[model samples]
Target: MTKSVGALTVRTDPTLKEVVVDGKDMSVYVFAKDTKPGVSSCDGECATQWPPVPAADAEAAKGLNQELLGSITRADGTAQLTLAGKPLYYFAKDTMPGDVKGQGVNDTWYASAPDGWKAGVKRQALGVLDHPKLGKILQDKNGRTLYLFTKDEPWR
Candidate 1:
């Protein structure tokens, strides 16, 4: 019998927003320690807990960018799938398809976004607040709304 190919896709989780998942809907993750593109730092015991997604026969799902999908040779000489240059992994504790127990683990592991960013991570350092008149506005970390003074001259 011919083996079926697996696919990678994006799904919206209540806590993780949009996360990249494997063909089985299992959440995929990235390691912050993996600072280099096309390389992986997760090995040995680390690999046992967070298994790398094999590159063989893996494809991007419909509506997903196929260009972002690639592969890298691991230390063991095996092929591991990569997204936007970052290696992908499966959390051992995530027994079910939608289990994201691996998110924020040790602050080093995170669910991957479609664009290969850490899913659910705040992109900006600023915060957001609801305004009665303006509807919504950006705020500082201290809860102060930010505004620009048009009359103020630009610094030289």
Candidate 2:
């Protein structure tokens, strides 16, 4: 259970950079399977491992848009906090405030960005290269290849 009502804030994670976290600094997450707003698919054993963040008394911290803060009723009839309509959660393994043990888990879980997007996964705005044998490939600004996995879905 949540100890007390807290504000949602952004923090710079070592790997994720800017990610949303509870006031206590515990990292929050968004499940890719949760495709609809005001809804959550994580329950039972899933809820046990990734607990839903309670919606009660949640507010956006400084620099975060309050308008994006919202809540959704879970299947269990409890209010879960949301960011831009995506449900927020806390990984059970994340004992410390900054722990992000759930990031990229099964390629379905990701730390939520401030705008309710996936954090840590940076998409290069430009830089595509053509290889003599490989044809065209995406690359980062620094010319590093951006390998996209076939199973990865776009996070909108």
Output the number of the TM-score-best candidate.
2
Q: Give one digit per residue, the lDDT tens place, for model 2 in 1-156.
A: 555548888898887788888889998999999976467989899999999999898999865678778788888788898876788888999999889999999999999877666789875576654343355667664345688688877893
Q: Number of clashing pairs, model 2?
A: 0
lDDT of each: 0.81, 0.81
Ten contiguous residues minimizing lDDT sum, candidate 2: 126-135
Error of 1 at 134 (Å): 39
**Over 4 Å off, model 2:** 124-156
Candidate 1 yields a Cα-based lDDT of 0.81
Models 1 onward score TM values of: 0.76, 0.76
The alpha-carbon lDDT assigned to residue 40 of candidate 2 equals 92
